[model samples]
Target: MTSLPPQEFTSVARAEAPLDENRGFACHVLIIGGGASGTLMALHLLNASPDMRVTVIEKSALLGCGIAYSTTDPGHLLNTRVHNMSAYPDRPEHFRDWLRQSGMAPGATDESFVGRQIYGRYLNDLIARERDLPEVSRLRCVKDECLRLEETPKAVIAHLGDGTCIRGDRAILATGHAVPVQSHAVLTSGWDFTPPADPGQPVVIIGTGLSMIDHLITLLRNGHRGTITCVSRRGLLPQVHTETKPLAISRGHVPLGAPVSAILHWMRGLAADAERQGGTWRDAVDGIRAHVSAIWRAWPEAERRRFLRHAASFWEVHRHRVPPDSARWLQEARDRGQLRILRGRFEEATMGEDGLIAVRIRTSGGERVLPAGRAVDCRGIRRDPAKDSAPVIQDLLARGQSRLDPLKLGIDTNEWAQVLLADGRPSRRLFAIGPCARGAAWEITAIPDIRVQCAELARHLHAIEAQDPVGVSRG
Candidate 1:
């Protein structure tokens, strides 16, 4: 694959030409959110179909970073290894190669983890190269939030917050992860608890997931010496990535249609077997990672739900391993007695007499009242249109343009990611990718997964565009 050139930001006035009276709509594709997933989809579509016109709408002023990569803090690092961070699976070493060529690193296979900001820069460069294509005469990017989406028999119309509408043959919703949930007590306090500046105050994190780890990193980097508490029902921190040698496990080790109890027994038996053979359970879990999706798919919905209710937390902790460096930092923080991880449930919260936020937590033992000078919730929020704050998603849900998944995981979609309607039919011109497609494919959030979806969606869109002779002719 060719490396993308540097991006040049120009105003819409300078880059876009006046729309011709005969040219009915704006572009062929109108991608919402110019983050990693959105830009990758655009790049794939343009490369696959050179004559296609693409336009990306980003609510933030910057593109390619979105919320995840928008952080300016040097402490925020990529959790995955550098080897698996490539945007393209075919070009397995693309990211490592880019890091070496861009002077971000000295070698391709260096074990050192790179900062998130550098990844943002690399994404921007990729977008720039796609924009510079010759066959792609129009690659307009608008800096406006989409407030509403109107689905017509012909095309999907996107209404911008600034009173502008753009129509496209197809729309791809790559709106990345939503903001972390904020505890009601913290919100009622009206306190500005931005990290680094207000590090003296004790804060309680809601979830002990990866997002919590990110917030913890920020708090530590900002020189906040105060006590930090992380609370969760399970209080399970992500597992640390190990460098143990690989071990092989056979496919038929566990039989299908086994009950949860039976499966747990089998897993335990396998662990004991491995240990007796001078191998650790980590090897078994690593082997399971290679076949997790298959296992997940094979299990019935009831079994999946049972796992979610019973063993999801523990499974997640083991599945989502943190980088070695991050694990070291977390370990040091714990050794220093600055960070506390508690397993409990949040009962209620109120403002204390000292003008701080007081939270009542119910743990396995009993109840305890804790006070924090300030608090920010790090429990990542789900993107459900019925419950999301975004006007666009709310409007779409209200107008029957989209439907929520039965489990409320995200928006409902068909296998191809075509947004499903309340009538249980797929929309021809509307599709969703990335986290929004969690309802269809449970494993659609990560970069590698989203990249593959983008390529597949691009191919599907290209086939549709080809079917419309008039649309192709106009373009």
Candidate 2:
């Protein structure tokens, strides 16, 4: 068994299941994955019902910080502003207030964008404070990976990697980003940037999205002198964040269920109108941020595929933005000939005779090979979860309890965040949120979207629990 780490500002304390012979009886909620999504779900459940109990099963000792927020780099500022990144949508200033009192960012404002590590600290503080609450001491943070889940007549049993089994009334799949864990040779992951032996040696990145920008920021801030090349189909970069009021848009005005082509034309007109009215396209895009999921839900599978084929890249560049300072650094790097953007598609990577990584990419004209000291796959968030997702997800897929959506963007899920079985039926006991259920919502990767989903799911679960009067074993 991997012994749980002692609790600290960053580490989470673990609680094992009771060793009673009847331990298979019902518990309240088993929230798998202790990243931001799981933590939010737990908190909302606790608030929804006075006696609700939550057990969070997470492999990593870092409680609330997942791969995204676990970065130790000081240069990684959050793409979203503090005003909109709160854990609670009703309390828009919750994170801002925490930042002020936590002593980490005493001077942070609503508009200020801080380091991702700092936000991770904020999430950790929430968990720590909740743990200290004796009156509501129902949340259990377990440091173990859930291998698989089995459904019973009354409860859901989760089998952990350490050979421990825990039963709950419900199991939530909050494993945020499908982290790519397997090792590779020629190409490295964008998540973990390993510094090359020679900083002067050229580096090639395989995507021009936000992830690529993150690599660039890290390299530039660390004083890397090599010429960096970023390659993608269109070489489109995320729009830079600027101070402008988001245009107020009504849901009725949005053309939900429209074709991808129609939606594109409508959005372009909206942006043009925003510019004519003294604002920029950013304001117009931001206006429809909350309605993105609704628009996505309205679309059928054919339209959704059309979006992925044609408009997904364009929408991402507009929706997911880069912070001001990072954008400035990137532009300056380009102006100084330290950065190069290539419009092409990454083909493959192989070791070259000169001991450098040779990255092959196909352009409009032809294919070419670029030799570099290191090549990193900065292919943004959409990873093949079938091969690279966390073990629990893989086990679910294999067991026919869950399957990847038709697009294979993520696990198949209904609108309510319920994991769909391979036979096209929703599982009553198993639920997935965040990136694991990406097929359900287009804009759910952001904190604002995820927190809302968590709150709503908790309420739904609470209602179901209230209907079932069966209580869990106290022992």
Candidate 3:
């Protein structure tokens, strides 16, 4: 990735004023959700324009700590390496430098998997510096939830939970993940709470992904001597991260618009060749990370659905991996007979008289019943936007301002992050970034992907501003 140039400030300063009409400050860019994605969006925008007014709305008081970073557990290490996790693509070592300069990880190396807390603080400090840029545009951070959005011919109005409305020339939704759904006998394994209190009891964790790993770590660290059973269709845990020799594959090396089967075959041959050459298959996998977006876009809708139904889990397990320390801990737990990973479908679950949950799973051989003291639904968030319970997102769909993509993964968006309406037309005043745009960009959640997105989105918005300097009728 190319590095962005350092931000330059002009001698234009705007007075800090309230968002109401009395102050006469309409936001040039209104960002909903002040997480890593939103903060990056704001930073890129401010860096590009010294006179543009931007407003960021966050439910929490903090600027950059989202669910991923809000966890205080030191055991929750970043899955990605330090060098690739930088917020700025141009300054690749920005985060590593910050880690060393802030005395958090004084001798942090590029390959180090630092704690998520340290990265959260780095993001907070970065947002602070950009928000307080000298003689630049006003960057207001609002500690309130955005309830609904109303798109007008000239501007977009966001209604807040506090019964206040703020208007902006353009609005971008970066609301991140939705709350996961849980069955009657299963619990949502969020970081907000701990596991059940029974040391020698058995527990069933549905899905064996990153969240499941986090739940297991939390229970183990708390000295829970229970049997942890992780059940999924494939029961495939993420591969452990290892040193990689970068493959020689470029963006266009792999053919696009091919059938899903052909794509799989091509990838398999690449991986096999890498293995024969005494290199890890992970190198081939990482080689194509930059082209996933284009490949996904070119894929037919039917082919995309086929991939999701058959290969999504396999793709996820290999694409997202854990740190070396995490892998060792998991291996040790399994060896101690305290953990079990099973490949099966968790069928009907019943709550027993003694408060235990009896889950029936269908394996290859036969059906088996497991009596667990607790059951956690670690299937992660439902990706379909139509099924999301988020107030602002639901309101958007109800008002016909936006529609879910055909694949149901996320909201419909164009290549430039423009939100598409129910009539299959792009909204002139509304856009989406981050997970909300996952329907269009499949590999966008990671820091490396989002950093480039933020820079590109800022450039697109700047082009629009240049077209309409008076901030009217940007369409």
Between prediction 1 and prediction 3, which has the larger TM-score? Answer: 3
Question: What would the per-residue lDDT of candidate 1 be over residues 355-377, giving only the tens digit for each residue?
Answer: 87787889988998888876556
| Alpha-carbon deviation at 43 in model 2, angstroms | 1.6
Q: Model 2, range 238-320, lDDT digits (tens) per residue? A: 88999977889999999998998998898899899999999999889999887899999999999999999988988999898
Candidate 3 — worst ten consecutive residues by lDDT sum?
A: 3-12
Q: At residue 407, give the lDDT of candidate 1.
A: 68
lDDT of each: 0.70, 0.82, 0.79
Native-vs-model 3 lDDT?
Answer: 0.79
Ten contiguous residues minimizing lDDT sum, candidate 1:
1-10
Give each model a TM-score: 0.86, 0.94, 0.92
Candidate 3 collision pairs? 3-90
**Candidate 2 Cα outliers beyond 4 Å, as residue runs:** 1-8, 14-27, 181-184, 469-475
**Which 10-residue window in model 2 sums to the lowest lDDT?**
1-10
